[model samples]
Target: MVSSTAQPPATKRLAGRTALVTGGSRGIGRAIAERLGREGARVGVHFGGDATAAKDTATAIEAAGGTAFTVQARLGKAGDAEGLWSAFDAQADGLDILVNNAGVNGGQVRPAEVTPEAFDHLFAVNTKAPFFITQQGLSRLRDGGRIINVSSGLTRGGAAPDLLAYAMTKGAIDVFTMTLAKELGARAITVNAVAPGVVDTDMNADWLRASAEAQAGVSAASPLGRVGVPDDIAGVAAFLASEDSRWVTGQWIDATGGALF
Candidate 1:
């Protein structure tokens, strides 16, 4: 039994805000962009070379009663971050949330087998891009804004030797989170990292959905007894973007489905 006057709860937590999600065309980035859009933030869907995917994400956001636009830049190239921001500036006046979600796995290669070329490229996109992106974004990022860096679960341990280089990048992200949190405390901005494990996105479809045994093994790896989805991590990113996380910063939130702990 319910009263006719009972109203629905509000879903718009970020009304009048603007967000930029790098690599927002697919997977966790897409999910985060959509989630932020749902919260009422006008999202800038940044994609490297996927115009269709980027447009689809923006269209989906608009269809859901939110606002969004697309920005493009091939990360790891010269002036990539600057190019992204330039395009972003033409669309939005300022930013309220910056989700540094673009990254690469650098393939599965051991330290001994890793090449200098691969290593440089990996750091360029995974580490260097975000660092300078944030640096350049400071002027546009409003006070009390949020900066969320997407990280990986491999940073917690060195068990995955094949991902040694990739894991190192996440470690740098974690450190960036802490250092930036401290530096931006005066302005009340919150900086944090969300590390996910074995998420069932297209990036992992090759192995994750390859066989029942493979899927079952991944599911069993997490104490929650399931593989993670993009939305699983998106929910966390939304929280960090919202005012509800005002007091939280410099934290490496494990959105890993209890895989490490």
Candidate 2:
């Protein structure tokens, strides 16, 4: 009954799958959306503002023989999650993956100087929005699905006194990912967090922007000897999105350049 050379069928991993990525207009989120498309998943690109950026992301996917649509919403707001999912609903029936990537620095440069208002804002986006969005996603995500939350290594290491508020938000994300993984495991859905090290994105380009010295300083400290690129994080996210990680959950994978706290 077993045929050695018999091909069972043509299996397309994500050929008919659908994924929604928040803050996909640019930076790490953009790269994630694009990578999912390359893997044959129809992408729902979520952007806060900058319609042009979202459009460009979608267009690039379409041009590269992939499927994608744009969904815009502010990640830190209450009603935005629903609206974002509503847009994704138009393109597909059920969601296969949800990538929570939208986050802010909380405007706190130092821990002692952080205000309650600024700190709260960081939780809203970095933690709260992702929590609520993941809740809503349960209704849309298939029984067997994937959820990836973005976090930062700052949460594990010592606080940047100034970046304290932002770091706290990431800590909340760590807990969220762990707890949700247990809750959703029975449903066959996996949840995990990807914590990144210092990335040379426009989000952090100010001090390190085009400055070789700044880059060198950061690079010299990390074991990898280089700052992060979008693709570096994207690769891990792509793995989490695929069946390759079907048995993995409730764990935080650090994409940091071997930078220890």
Provide the global lDDT of candidate 2 against the true structure: 0.84
List TM-scores for all candidates, in order. 0.95, 0.92
What TM value does model 1 have? Answer: 0.95
lDDT of 2 by residue, 1-261 (tens): 111122122234668889999998798899888888878899999988899999999998787778899987787777877877787777779899999998888553766677778777788888889988888889999988999999998877667788877888889899999999999999999999999887877798777777878778878767767787787888789889999999999999988878873
Q: Which window of 10 residues has the lowest lDDT sum in candidate 2? A: 1-10
lDDT of 1 by residue, 17-127 (tens): 999999999999998999899889999999999899999999999988889999999999999989999999998999999999999887678889999999999999999
Clashing pairs in 1: none
User: Which residue pairs collide, candidate 2?
Assistant: 109-162, 110-161, 110-162, 111-161, 111-162
- In terms of lDDT, the best-performing candidate is 1
